[model samples]
Target: MNEQEKSDGIKRVIPARYNRLMTDPLLREIVSGLDGVAEALAAKQQANVLFDELGTPPPDYAREAAGFIGSGKVDKDWIGRVAKDELAKLVRAEQRKHVSDLINGCLTQLDSIAEYSVDDVLAELDTRLQELVQPLYAAGEKLTGVDTPTDAIRRGLTEEWRLFADAAIEYAKIRAAQKIAVSVAPEEFKDRGQSAACEDPHANSSVIANIAEVWESWNTPPQAELAWSDNDEGDRVARWVRPRVEAPWPVQTDEFLLWCIRNDAELRVPDLGQM
Candidate 1:
């Protein structure tokens, strides 16, 4: 690229990088605990018992006649009945323990992949991004306009946040990095020798440019439902079109726009445009 292009590219960054500021160490722990409990419940074992009748007793009429004579002795066993009840209780207890172990296993295994994966990249990106972004929330209210606290501080934070986010998005798009035990490159790559090429600043710069372009392009279409009429020589026609926004950009807008953009599909189309 030309020197001017390269210079401009070097100056761009993405907003997602600032999101790392919101990272909470305790959040993962809580999720892991919940997962452990869910797994424990899911892995429970069950116990059952079956009763067998040794033989059928004689018919009521036959037994009644024989009861008066009393020629034979009645024999029954209590040991078998007692043993069955005890076995069932013991089996149930064992099953409960087995289920508990399963839950513990799930808790331990939550999001702990040995190699690089989408989740791993996403988690890193989320945590890092939040860490960089959370500082912007200086007031009690949610983030609205860019003007807040001190302008110089805000600008510096914004720049760094964009840079980090841009780098992360570019890294994720590569896709090849999602391999076994692959170590992601550092944020600022340093050339070690003649064998390696210089870091591609344009890679991130291009992504940021695209993001800005799409945002501006999408914004060009007014979201408000406008009411206007066309007058023909002998007829009058009136119509209105309701606007809608779909995924991807909507996600980005909601995340970065402080929910100022439509969320939960609830919008106010006032007759006079008042809140």
Candidate 2:
């Protein structure tokens, strides 16, 4: 792709302005805090559900109470313990409201973020996405430097590393769907632009194949004819690298992927013009 085309591709995945916005510390803090709030709320809900099921007393207490009423047998201590348990459960139930309030606080924070520019949130998203791919990008750079480039070894090694980058890029996009409101799709190779000729020293057949596989895996299903590679080639490579999402809130998958691809492209191939 030409510089403009490459840039456009990057923008399509992650708009430059928005990608920058993601880096804002304030935005990231809000997202992290909100996710924590959500988790606390979920915990409270679990406790409430348990309280509702267990009721005012444990089963043993209820049975004893029944026996006392039926057979003139009374155990005050058992009743007291049951009452204590029931009170404990009620306290937990009451705490559920507190959880609800905390969640509301998070929603309020999210609403506050809504007032901010799309660019800022997007920038944060981009940063997180880059984090996800960093391990693979570093690995790819490292391996490319260390490996002896034979046709077989070249394909096996480089492509495998690239796959890590690709998978990380793809999965980040998929994950972004839950955070942002926008719809973003992973970029695909609709048509092969150029074949890596046998004489091309820089091109590895494995890399080329995995590139196609990367595109296909995003678009296709696990049961579909095209899926992630599972060969000795596949085993040596990871399907996806983890990208850190700045925001805890889930975003639209496509936009997330776009940002990830744009951010990761340079790392994967330094020569943007040629890529």
Candidate 3:
């Protein structure tokens, strides 16, 4: 078929394939489950059971159940029923946990799939394949003393086939890397002060100073007068302060510094020492 004919055929086939995909039950389930709608429904059913037992509507069930549990009017039969129901809940929670884990795995796979763009992959393939075949085309022209339509077509096909083989090999490598990335925890890949340092290499000293300042501020003891206060004794004094140097940066600077300290990066705040 000619190029236009082939293009037209692809256009028609793609829409039909898309329609079929959209109508697929599995795909519909996946799309709906992306927002945890199914999990919400299951939770709602559990809530309904609790509502019925409490003899109250869903909205008022929580208060009613709390009162029922706290009241001193409980008998042996009530205690046994509650215990039985609690055991049933524990069993159901264990089963749901297994299903939740499986769903999470599927969601992670979908995220990875979504990360790749078909157009981008196709473009890269085309570019790399062209680069791979250029030398072959040049060699063919040199051997023939002059380029011809037949020579060009043969060289193109040779390059295309070689590209296909190379693509398969590259695809395997990509899959391996993706698997490794998935297997590794995100926190494991996190660098200490590297992100802050990389954000502005020219202002490394300022960045380090700011990070140290924030860290010290977080761990510093409250003033003597403030120490006696209740608010200062809690999270009030422990609240994170964003580093001045990394202010314009998107990430949480204090958290990044903490990660750096935890990972034991070479970062040091002159007077502050190791951290």
- Candidate 3 global TM-score: 0.22
TM-score of 2: 0.26
lDDT string for model 2 (107-222, tens) is 44434444343334344544554565556544454453333334325556655454554654555442342233221112232122333222221122211323343333322222
Q: What is the C-alpha lDDT of each candidate?
A: 0.32, 0.39, 0.36
In terms of lDDT, which candidate is strongest?
2
Order candidates by lDDT, high to low. 2, 3, 1
Candidate 2, overall lDDT? 0.39
User: Model 2, poorest ten-residue lDDT window?
Assistant: 266-275
lDDT of 3 by residue, 1-275 (tens): 01122321211112221222225343333333344435544564564454334331113234545676789554557556666766776665555444444433443443433233222322333344335334433333333322333443565544533433454354333323222222222343212333342344312331243544434332233333322223744743433433433432224332232233333322322211111
Cα miss at 36, model 2 (Å)? 11
Better of 1 and 3 by lDDT: 3
Better of 2 and 3 by TM-score: 2
Model 3 / residue 184 / CA error / Å: 20
